[model samples]
Target: MIVAEKKPIEEIIDQVKDFQKLLIAGCNECVTVCEAGGKKEVGILASALRMYFMNEGKKVEIDEVTLERQCDHEYLEEIRDRIDKYDAVLSLACGVGVQFMAEKYFSTPVFPGVNTCFMGAAEERGVWSERCQACGQCILGETAGICPISRCAKRLLNGPCGGSTKGKCEISKDLDCAWQLILDRLKELDRLDDYEKIMPIKDWSTERAGGPRKVVREDVRL
Candidate 1:
């Protein structure tokens, strides 16, 4: 899942201080799972903003709404009729969703409400751990499903890096050594011998930084 955390309220307030009418938009997708920009979060933020303004003797028009997804044009179109009513939009979505809203409403100011964290899994009720860097190349099959790119500080294709101490990473005592994780997983599956394989350098051309990559099936194209 695309794990994210809410941005600081103070930071968000700075972006739309001049706008009396603000729309706090949330998404029902990734950010929702992380509890960063779900419908409930939208209400909480909206109320807080109202209280903050009221305390300062300012009358601000703050409305909160949640869309099925801020990234989809079809879903965002539903807000077109209501969007013009606000001076600025505070997107409580991931960076992608915020950008999509900005692209669709170029005349209105758009602000981000969350910081996109990492590609991770939900470990528990309130815990999420980084698992993949989405580096445009995948090496999980060869490494017993443990990702070196995201977990290892060095991003070493072959790791333990001569820097790991005991079973912890050298960069931080709190982190488990990524190579140690790979070895343990490989040992459990009796695939320890596979660790000798040298991973190829990642081809970054398919990544977002390379400019949007797309796939089209001519057979399906009408």
Candidate 2:
């Protein structure tokens, strides 16, 4: 999942201060999972932005709404009519969501209210850890399903990058060396032989390539 953090209320207000009418938009997907851009968070931000402007003696009209997933065009269409009434949109979603909204509504200026973070998995209730770098190459088959692209500082394809000290990555001692974990898992499965295989050069063009990739199922296509 892609993680994100909400931008400061003050900054958001500044961005749309000149606009008397504003719409605070939220997403119910990854940003919601991270507790940054959910419906509730959107309301809070809307209220805060309103308060900030009001306190400055500036009259501002603000309304809030949440889309199930801003990345989808259908959900975005639901807000088309409502958005037309606003001067600008403050999307409390990830960068992708904001971009999609802008793409869908060319007349409206969609502003991002969150800083998009890395692709990661949730650790606990509020903590998320990076797992995949989306490097266009997957090496989980040989490394016991652990990704080194995001976890390892060197992104080594085979063995430790020889920079690990005391099982910690040299780039940052706080992080564990991804290769070390791979070795342990490989040993447990008696698949250490797979480690010797050389990883082929990754073709990034195939992953996110020429244009936006889409899935069209013959059974589901209209």
Candidate 3:
């Protein structure tokens, strides 16, 4: 899932301080699980903003709403009738959702409420770890399910670079060497032979380096 962290209240206040009316929008998906932007978080933010305005001797109208997903057009359209009622919208969705809302509305000012981190998984409650970089070219098949691209400090295709020591990355003893993990995984799977095969230079054009990407599915299109 896409991981994100909430912005500081002071930073958020600075962004929407001039607006008399504001809408705090949250998502029910990834941000919800991560405890950053969700129905509960929206209410909390709304309360904080309300208190801030009240203490500043200013009157502000703050509304809170959580969409099933802010990225989807269908969910976004739900606010169309009342979107103009607010001076600005603080979106608690991922960067994608914030951009989508900005594009869809065009005229209304949209602000991000959270910092989009990366595509990752929760290692445990309150702890999320990076898992994939979405490099477009997947090489997990030969690496025994360990992703060297995202896990490696240098994104090395084939390595346990000389920098690794005691199964840890050179960058940090706390960090495990991605290649070491892969080697161990392969050995357990009895596929250590696959590790000997070197990977060709990756075609990065398939990634974001090529620019914004899109997929077209003729079968699913109208």
Candidate 4:
């Protein structure tokens, strides 16, 4: 899941202070899971903003709406008719969702209300750890399901590097050595021999190197 953190209220207030009519849009997907920009968060933010404006003796019209997702056209279309009513929109979705909203509603100014953190998994409630970098080519099969690209501080392909000691990364005592975890997993799977085979140099083009990417399924197209 993509994890995000809400921006400081001060920064958000500064961005929409000039707009008399404002919309606080939320997403019901990943942001909801991460507790950043969901329906509840939208309400919290709206209330805070309302209190701030009221105390300041300023009049600002702030409305709240939570969409199933802000990254899809169908979900975004739900607000098309009402979008023009607001001077600006504060999207509490991920960076992708904010950009999608901006692109779809080109007339309205779209501002991101959260900082897109990373593709990660929940370690515990309110805690998420990075797991994938979307490097185009996956090597998890060879590494026994642990991702070195995201976990390794150096992004080492064949590693533990000389910097790892006692299964801990030299960079930090709290950080586990990703390669060590791979080796242990490989041993447990009786696939330790696979470790000897050198991995080929990764072609980074499959990643963000080639600009915007598109995945097409011709079979699914109308």
> What are the models' TM-scores?
0.92, 0.91, 0.98, 0.96
For residues 179-212, what per-residue lDDT tens digits would candidate 3 score against the true structure? 9999998999999899889888889997898998
- Cα lDDT tens digits, model 1, 23-142, are 999999988999999999999999988998899888899998999998899999989999899999999988889999999999999999999988898889998999987776787888
Q: TM-score winner among the candidates?
A: 3
Q: Where does candidate 1 have its weakest 10-residue lDDT segment?
A: 198-207
Candidate 1: deviation at residue 174, Å? 1.6
lDDT of 4 by residue, 102-195 (tens): 9999999999999999999999987898999998889898899999999999888875799999999999998899999999999999999988
What lDDT does the true structure give each of the candidates? Answer: 0.89, 0.86, 0.93, 0.94
lDDT of 2 at 69: 96
Q: By lDDT, highest first, what's the ranking?
A: 4, 3, 1, 2
Query: Which of 1 and 3 is the better model by lDDT?
Result: 3
Candidate 2 displacement at residue 77 in angstroms: 1.3
Poorly placed runs, candidate 4 (over 4 Å): none
Q: Judged by lDDT, which candidate is best?
A: 4
Q: Supply the global lDDT for candidate 1.
A: 0.89
Superposition error at 204 for model 4 (Å): 0.4
Better of 1 and 4 by lDDT: 4
